[model samples]
Target: MIDFFLAHQRNPHFTGRSSILKDLKGALTEGGPAVLIGPDGMGKSAIAEEHGRVNVTEYDFRLWVRAWDATVLATDYAGLAEPFGIPHQEDSDLQDLASSIRTWLEENERWLLVFDDAPSPEVLEEYLPRPGSGGGGVIITSKSPGWDGDFAKIEVGPLDPSEAASFLLSLTGQEDAEASKKLAEALESLPLALELAGAYIGWTGVPISKYLDIYRKRLGEISGRTSGLPEALVAVADISTEQVRAVSQEGIDLLRLSAFLAAEDLPLDLLVKTSALLADSVEMGLMALDRRGLVRRDEEPLSVHPLIQALAYSRLDDGERKTWADETVRAIGGAFSTYLGDLSTWPECARLLPHALASSEKVEDLRMGSEPASLLLNQVGLYLHRRGDLAGARNVLERLVVLDERFYGRGHPEVATDLNNLGSVLRVLGDLRAAKGCFERALAIEEAQDAPDRLKIAIRANNLGTVLRSLGDLTGALAAFERALAIDREAYGPNHLKTAIRLNNRGEVLQEMGDLDGAKESYQLAFRVFEQFLGPGHHYTQRARENLDSLSQSESD
Candidate 1:
């Protein structure tokens, strides 16, 4: 009798599903076949296993079968026969084995059977005991919702938000109401996600706030090595994705794009832009995904569950991921502004930032220099830099340099541009020597070109001068600044913004060299140019005026 019951692990921290438990007990007590139907991570299997655990002594015999474990449901009776202690006979057919099992069950009184993770109604119907024929009951859990034919059906969903919050609190022994609520909301109240969150929190002793931060930043890595909760969530997602793919390849492609975007309120327009499918075909694909619970589209913008998104991303191979990433960048670039001057488009830009950042990181991993990759790197790098994410900016700019070098080779103008951008980030990070080296390399590249870009050469010289000054090399700094000023004056004339910038650079260098009179003259000239061309309210004009004022104040003192 002990051998008949399979050992099932119970959730130690399970909480708050009294109503479902009552319904499950009612169906089982009546000796009727019952099916628990729901999406993955809803605790359907847990409920079934819990009932089996509690009722282990009531039944004369009990058996558990993983119905989908076998390749051919029709031919695989081994899972069914195993609990009866029946060994496989090479000569016996599946029918004979199934018959022997049925005979054994018929001889037993008050027996129970559970078919966990049944793939579909048709697949399991033949294996199930005939309705009202058995002395005991049968319980099955499935991802399909339409498995209720001639059986009591219980639909399991996410735990109530309060219940989910309570569950987290109980598991972690935390008194934080707000953090628990936030964590529950972030996990979308899924049982598996909650369990994983609790396990991670308990193991790491991280506060709820820090856990949420790590969860967001490392979502794709959630299933890397952890067992139990993460594995369960990923298994469910894999089955769901395979089901969707079996129905429509378009659906699978859509799932890939959704993984790179925000999990909630994902804009369908953006999704459609990424796909090459016709609009109607895209609609059909989304419908297929919706039907499988891989994505939901009841609202205006479609959304995928966070766990599902993470699973989808983790499943892709490198090549397929690069292809999808390229498509994602192209789609977003079509809708969002790549040029930094487009401030009016900022609302949309802000909305796309999370997705863009994620996609840009994927593009960087490919290390290819395609147009879409370049666009993603350029925009994301600039955005991160402007937003004061200096580390993120450096990461993106460093990749951009690699990609530019690969695409255009050394000494190309694009490579020089990439190097200059990286140099700027390095300077801000206070790696003065490294920044100087980057700037010098960029200047050499610019100068080596047959039809050298005079403006770029001037910009690189100015940047190099700034780094040299930071390194306390006053002579090299002044020389570089002078060259920049001369180039800017020749290229764009004295009144241009570039020329004004170069003049300001020279003024700073002169001041650093103790040439107060020369510094004052340079500052005054730069201030006049900036004020006339850029207006007094402009940042450049204001900075130039401040420099001249400092010189006068020092003289008066």
Candidate 2:
């Protein structure tokens, strides 16, 4: 049931935007003209095609027109008339052609006309049928938003985040909720970007995590030969960018800087730091960008859509990109605090995490070993680990370790810290051997110093003990725990959480070694300390209680 003189092919994996489709259908059913306006690559034409496909039976005659750059609307009628089997003469007078089209529409009981990719309202104004001239409706899709006179406007934005995520999962036949959501967010929930990503994944059999890596590395370059989305992301971006540049060069510059930062809630203060433009000029530049639909500006911060950010970054030359990327690193890095252990600062750190990761990548790419860059990597890596993104954590922390070792040598305190962090991830990942080696190397480096960090040594010993225990080296684990206990007792007192933790660890090794009475004594002491300092309901106290109970039951048996 497809009637097409010039209808664009529908998307096979088309998903979501039901409400917008409904609204377009409602307008069409009421016999009114509707315009779908949005930025390039937002699937405006696809929605129109889907609407036409679903409602093909409602119209007696259906016509599609490619109104983009159509200088003479009358001459284009021959192409429109071809589908309906209506005879047309190329040499006919323009008025006669118009009369013929009008007469056909009046005679037909119902008909649908879709003016796809209209360049402007003025261009389509001459071609639009008059009110009550036809029974069916007209639909138009355009990049330009100015569709004023007598057309019901539907602003086709990106799909909803949930819908976009579901579309990706369905397209790839994957059931990973986290990865789907992350992919959806990374692509900015744009339908074309999501489609391209899904196509790439399905074609290559790449996991969602690996696809995210490729997408982050080459967002603008990701494309496929999908039916409806013929143009690559970079090509669409180039078109929009050319339009923005035509309006203002400052807008282009603003977008380029935004490309190196996060896609959402970009701080104006951070932008001001990197930009040489005065506050007023920056505001005007943002206004120009906003007008072109390249960026969204709020009261405090500005944001560029994710796809726009990727496109903007892709447009930069190597030298100019390096300069802007460095500036972005400095701006975002300056704002981010390296001390992530402070619970009060976590919200701000989480807010900055995306930008921090972007800036850190730029820093790594340029091999610029500034303090801010180091701090950005360290904090973001730690934050990712805390957030339970183990793969992401491993990637950043591994890079941090390599960089630190290269810059400060293998024996540096920073290298040891990186090693300790990496070891923690390895332990959680169940690589006990690698984790043990990491802890050993960190402990060795720390102990070799004339004036070592006693606290660091104690923490490393505690980590090593746990890994050793997991490897079933009960004696070695017990020794490691005792060393940590001795250090913590001297450094933080016997009642401290660190000391209690070491005591509990030592008790676990003792039980494993079949010294049940010794384990019982150690657990009792640890439990009393935890209850006094952290309360009986604390996790540490409960663990000590369970360990003591287990040991007591074993002795009775």
Q: Which candidate is the best by TM-score?
A: 1
Worst 10 residues of 2 by lDDT: 69-78
Tell me the RMSD of model 1 versus the true structure: 24.9
lDDT (Cα, tens digit) per residue for candidate 2, span 1-557: 32663324455677888999899988876777899999866878778878877877786666766565332233344345655556754333444555667667656656777786787888655567777776767888888877776789999988899999998987787888899999888778877667656755664477988877765655455454222332445543444456567767777777887877755567666557644532435666776666444664545546565567766766567777777766776777666756666666655655576677776676677665556566678877776666555656777788888767766888998889999999999998888899999999999999988899998999999999999999988788888999999999999887777888888888889888988888888898899999998888999999999997887688678
lDDT of all predictions: 0.72, 0.73
Predict model 2's lDDT versus the native: 0.73
| Global Cα lDDT for candidate 1 | 0.72
Model 1 residue 492 lDDT? 81
Candidate 1's displacement at residue 430, Å, is 3.4
- What TM-score does prediction 2 earn? 0.54
What's the C-alpha lDDT at position 538 in model 2?
90
Q: Model 1: per-residue lDDT, tens digit, 436-531? A: 989999999988989988878888988998899888999999999999899889988877778778888888888877899899888888898889
